[model samples]
Target: MKLPHPIQYQGSKRNLASQILQYFPLDIETLIEPFAGSAAISVAAAYNNYANKFIINDLNKPLLNLLELIIEHPNKISNNYEKIWNKQHINSVEHYFEIREKFNKSKDSSLFLYLMARCAKGAVRYNKSGEFNQSPDKRRKGTIPERMKKNIMGVSSLLKGKVKFKSEDYRLLINDISEKDLLYMDPPYQGVCSNRDSRYYSGIDHSEFVVFLEELNNKNISYIISYDGRLGDKKYGEPMPKHLNLEHIEINAGRSSQATLLGKKDITYESLYLSKALQKRIINDNQNTLIMKELKYA
Candidate 1:
């Protein structure tokens, strides 16, 4: 089976696969990913064959169409991605923006995926004019993984019919969700990554998110949310929030995205991993040292 998250998405939850799965109930009948970006959580969920039904969502229509094609024709996608993997061109800012704008206009999923890989910083940047504006990276490394196409196909097969893809307001989802369902929401980060200037993340509001969290707090259904951590870092070693009775964790959110905003604030610090019991365990173990220090200093 092709790996489901064939197309790379910014802020993918591949990192959260293990943690999210652990927190998820074993008896889930339906798996819902409200912010299904990289299929990180969804791909892993489908691969495990855990849920009898899967509900995947993202606001980007083009990205959704890519998912549609993946569901419909895996081999065709692999062949198209092959064309992308083999092609070469001058790598520059204008060249990237130009290529991306032109390519976005095309009705081709492989082209979209290829540009996403080749563009500047892998950020899906855009202009107010609705143009792709991320410059090209002259020094970018590696071809699209030699195994990328195969992986996508693998995921597609695993998700066959067990999956339902949708593009809708996450708030609207509460209408259909049941008390027993599990919802995974990895919305764009609060300050920088939220869907204001960013093209890829789309519009998810803080108020809306807070409401969603409140609903989760009120409902009997289980949920896990991935959002920005404080300290301008992903591993927030600070004490858990008093109100939520939450947990905080410190994990290397990968070395590449270690920037402050994504992390590259140029300072050294970390953010918290907000979750339920399992995160409490991970944080209580190793991060307690720093937590105590922060307590002493604060």
Candidate 2:
């Protein structure tokens, strides 16, 4: 029997992978994922027994650092998680703070796993000093999976030199793609996290994302761009070229409270709208960079 494919993300789009896979041809030579948050796409493609022509990139340093540990020293990190997971903690804010302090002092994947597992609501937050500031999950007790160490070790074994991970600003990744390359770009949500300072996704400017999309369009690279339709401002609007195809996808984001630390039990589901806009630009005379679209999100 074939080995069962592992879903390597805390909140992965494995369910949507099948639909997204439709955008990709089976015989494609390369997969270009510029914003590989949590490596959902990379892990999914690798699990499907694809070739090693996957190039994944992200700007976040800590997240990539953890993945490096998972790739290089999975056993030690898994052992670290098992050791940390076995300990019991009292339901006190003070105990949470103590663990948080320790997590900040260490930079290994073991501490990363422990913090992610035990942190309140599993939000990875850091202070200006780059310290792990998320509190402990006091409401629920953690149940460490049996043989979790081995399972994590299995993540590295599964990857096995088939995936190439990169840490860089996605805007600079256009050079990495060519014609016929399948690029699945999952950038940070435009506005939902902007209004609240509690969100960990910082420094992602929506305007920059629009520019990035334009670059990809100019290069004639095949790609599927995912973004939020519920813009923070109702005044927001976008104009996709009449030539490129446009499509909408609606998926419930679900109750926010159940999905986050503040657990207000919000029923709002985040609907992801994917678009493929490619249009012919009419150039009369002088031309610099042909701008096809300006992203206007709510």
Candidate 3:
């Protein structure tokens, strides 16, 4: 079963979820995403036979609230979304700004979701004052209501009883993870993108995150982290802690949408840092076909 991501999230691994899941251990009783932007990995994992319980936690309240609405009241969200989507917004940009203003003032979950669906490049942006600032995509017509409804229903069904959504900082979620759980963390990148995109959501404190990883490492917890990788010739992202020994697998992510937006013509690559424990398990299971050590990032 294929499930489309309900929203387009910057630095999302929605396209690469299958490939990323291949690196996870087959016996995960619980799957958790601490920085669950789009919760793409968890959503994708829900369809897989491996994990039964899923935890999706993020500090972004508005996004998490929208996700919760979908999980609990798919029909409600669908109905509200259709009202906004099916109507004619004569000037799409002006209509988008109008919705943005309402969303900023009201913090309405339904309106926020609508904005996400219609925003430029499906990218969510905000100004320093914490207002939605992304412009409308001028090139293509937004997804039709029929398709949107189908996706909403499908994703909601996929996530129904198995998934739990939490609005919390990544650090607090860390304590909830157990040895039987597989943690998939797609934290914000450390460099330029983090600084530029921090306005959209809270930025990660790299130093604190590294310290947390060390704590997890000391406990021998298994995880797969999507952090700093490469974009064409120029590399962007952060590396693992200096003292941590982990296996790094680079996934070929095709062209970067962000790069395309910036008018650059370079292939993008993503790095998946697996805890040593998980790496050993994958190797033992003979599922390490794309190990970065043997193959170049294509």
Candidate 4:
């Protein structure tokens, strides 16, 4: 199924959601996303009925608020978006920067959505003072109002009552996670964005993140992390420590668009790390499936 995504995020797992979800158990009480950019995984999980409830959290307050509006008050957000999008007809670039200035001051979710749609490459970049500074994509205007409405409404219908929105540090959120809940983490890439990359307002320390993973293991919580990977021979981030005992899988994310444009056939592979407990559950689920198939044949 083509999942609905109201926003275009640069590193969104929307395209890779199905492949990542293959490891999810058939039953999940809650699916928590600590770094829920666009909440792509949560949206996919809800679409596939893989989780009964969802907790979507992000440190980016404006982005999280935009998501909340998309999931709870679709009509209001869609209408506001249309108004903003329509104004750009006269001078799209000027209108985009105007919206960006307003968003930085007001932090209005609707304005944030408009800027996200019109931003160059859908890349979220912030200055030292935490301002949205990405330039507009002059090649084309943002998504049309009709398509935006459809996507916003589709996401709202799927997750309105089933989701809880949060704007908090991931560390604070993880403390409340229970064994029944499954956590899917797509944290800032260690090397690329972990050290205060302009893409984020702030960056997580690699050592601190490792310690956080250790704590999760101690609590026996199940998690799936989309941490790091490579493009051709060049790797992006440091590998997860072996001591964590997480099962690592590399997903082929297909050819890199940048590489293709450069006339290089470099395939981008993303790293997926699964907690040991989750891995064991997946193995058991597969065995049961095979057993059921054999019995039916007999």
Tens digits of lDDT, candidate 1, 10-30: 566675576556555555667
Ranking by TM-score: 4, 3, 1, 2
Give the alpha-carbon lDDT of every model: 0.63, 0.57, 0.80, 0.90
Ranking by lDDT: 4, 3, 1, 2
- Residue pairs with colliding backbones in model 3 are 228-237, 228-238
Which of the two candidates, 2 or 4, achieves a greater TM-score against the reference?
Answer: 4
**Taking the tens digit of each residue's C-alpha lDDT, what string does model 4 give over 13-91?**
9999999999898767899999998999999999999986999999898889899999999999999999999999899
* Poorest 10 consecutive residues by lDDT, candidate 4: 192-201
**lDDT tens readout by residue for model 3, 82-161:** 88876636776777778889999989988888888888778888787777888888775477777777877878888878
Q: On lDDT, who's better, 1 or 2? A: 1
Q: Which stretches of candidate 3 lie over 4 Å from their true place?
A: 192-199, 257-265, 287-298
Q: How high is the lDDT of residue 260 in model 1?
A: 38
* Best of the two (3, 4) by TM-score: 4
Candidates 1 and 3, the one with greater lDDT = 3
Worst 10 residues of 3 by lDDT: 191-200
Q: Which candidate has the highest TM-score of all? A: 4
